[model samples]
Target: MKNLVALLLLSLLYLHGTTSLAEDINSDAETLPAFCTSYKCPRYQLIKKYEKFEHRIYNATNWVTTSLKLDFLGIGLAKSFKRLLDYINGKNSEGLVMKMTVPVRIKVPRSDILSTNATMSFFVPPAVDTLPTPLNPDIYVEQLPEISVYVRSFGGYALNSDYEKQAKILVEELEALELSYNSSYGTAAGYNDPLTFFNRHNEVWYMAL
Candidate 1:
């Protein structure tokens, strides 16, 4: 009888262990992070700005160097404009924005982002770079374009995986709009705080074509 009891106890423990493991797996799958299909408004600060617009030019005739340059360019601009947000709106805002000298679009050709990076570098000024500034009480979000776009917002690092997910969601939304996109013409915008995760930082995916 003791042996049977022991076996029953062991069986119960085994079942409990399996059930817990299954629950954990289910919980983890359920907790899988979700992506937002709308825009986000984060607090921002404005430092200074030059009156009137200036046209910046960039040339990426070289492939390797241009790739790095484009990466830096994106990073710098995201920071600089975030600070500039303080000036445009108020001491507190949720984001920053600017009108592209030209309608900007991301075109990954032949699934070749590296080559496309070189070509895309031809759009912006070469010397122009993102300038970091001290945080202030302002947000400088750019004006929303008249062109219809399905914006997907995400937090944390704008990893390629997150981008892929957002891009897919945006495409699906656009399809519902009856608008055509090449699926390669994606434009990105995002915000991040150097200090905290709870702070408002978001990335937006758009179809620029």
Candidate 2:
């Protein structure tokens, strides 16, 4: 009788452990970054990881972008986001409401003197063949070739200054490695909802020359 009681207790403990582990896995899946769940986002393989940088090879991707030629980065981004959101909300010629993707990318020129114009882009999902024509003339679609890039990632809310600082760090690391990269252009990628307060993912990407 004692042995049977012992066996029963062990079974109960085993079931409890399994249940807890399953719950933990479900919680983790629910908390995955938006970038990982989006099929439209660029696919990349991590080639190298450094203390402050990562080298990656990214596959070719299609994008829908809007150009905002404003002096301030924040203002330009705001306008671009508004325009792009409208496109995704069915403000297009086909009146199609596109799926929202993660890691909204912004490209900036790489001059010491800041440029007035910047391009903000969203990834086009694979199933979207009949591309919607943007009602706004400033928005357009383009297919980009596969490229290799070095990236620096950071947490929390991303501001222009944060991106600039991280980009500088990546450049220094690349120099240390004797790597050549395109200095004329770079991209900033954001991978979190606006309301996310912690563990936010932001990255600055520089193309390999």
Candidate 3:
């Protein structure tokens, strides 16, 4: 009888553990911020009111790379786009393909972004362009109207291991504020650098906000 009782307790414990894990995953998924909820996000505000840029779907596939200086983001993105094009053309089969929106929103603080000191997550974007049959030199950087996003700020840079910790903090904040969010929001990039930044660094977390 004692053995049976112990066995039953163990079963219950295992079930509880599985349930807890599932809950954590669900909670993380649901913590996604609203679209362009930032004061500094001009693109977000512009789209919110004017809808000047019609929403168009695009594709993207991102891989992890270290951005130790933050300055490399814009250039990195350009390279990534080049890679993405290569993949589409069957040049690189190792890369992944994904779908996202164009004119994607970016987030910084209400004050100067350099002073924001927050972890950022940006959307990996893809867009179609009208390059003449010969391909024009001026239509290189595709124009995308920006959208809105929700944001939660954090301090310090970190490695991949720190995602759960930061995500949990954002999750708690979202829940505390009773915000409505999507379950699809998940971690993409883990590191960012600022020294090479031509645009910004505090622009780190660009999830579905």
**Cα lDDT for residue 33, model 3?**
24
> Among all windows of ten consecutive residues in candidate 3, which has the lowest summed lDDT?
1-10
Per-residue error (Å), model 1, residue 5: 59
Candidate 2 wrong stretches, greater than 4 Å? 1-40, 112-116
* lDDT tens digits by residue: candidate 2, 1-209: 00000011111122122211111111212232354443246667788888888888877777888875534434445667778777876789987776566567777777522355567788775556667888999899888888888888877676656777777788888889888998777787876654456666778888887
TM-score ranking, best first:
2, 1, 3
The positional error of residue 36 in candidate 2, measured at the CA in angstroms, is 3.8
> What's the lDDT for residue 163 in model 3?
36
TM-score of each: 0.34, 0.77, 0.31
lDDT of 3 by residue, 34-53 (tens): 33221111222212211111
Clash tally, candidates in order: 20, 0, 23
**Local distance difference test values of all predictions, in order:** 0.30, 0.64, 0.26
Order of quality (lDDT): 2, 1, 3
Which of 2 and 3 is ahead in lDDT?
Answer: 2
- Show where candidate 1 strays beyond 4 Å: 1-110, 118-148
lDDT of 2: 0.64
Which residue pairs show backbone clashes in model 2? none
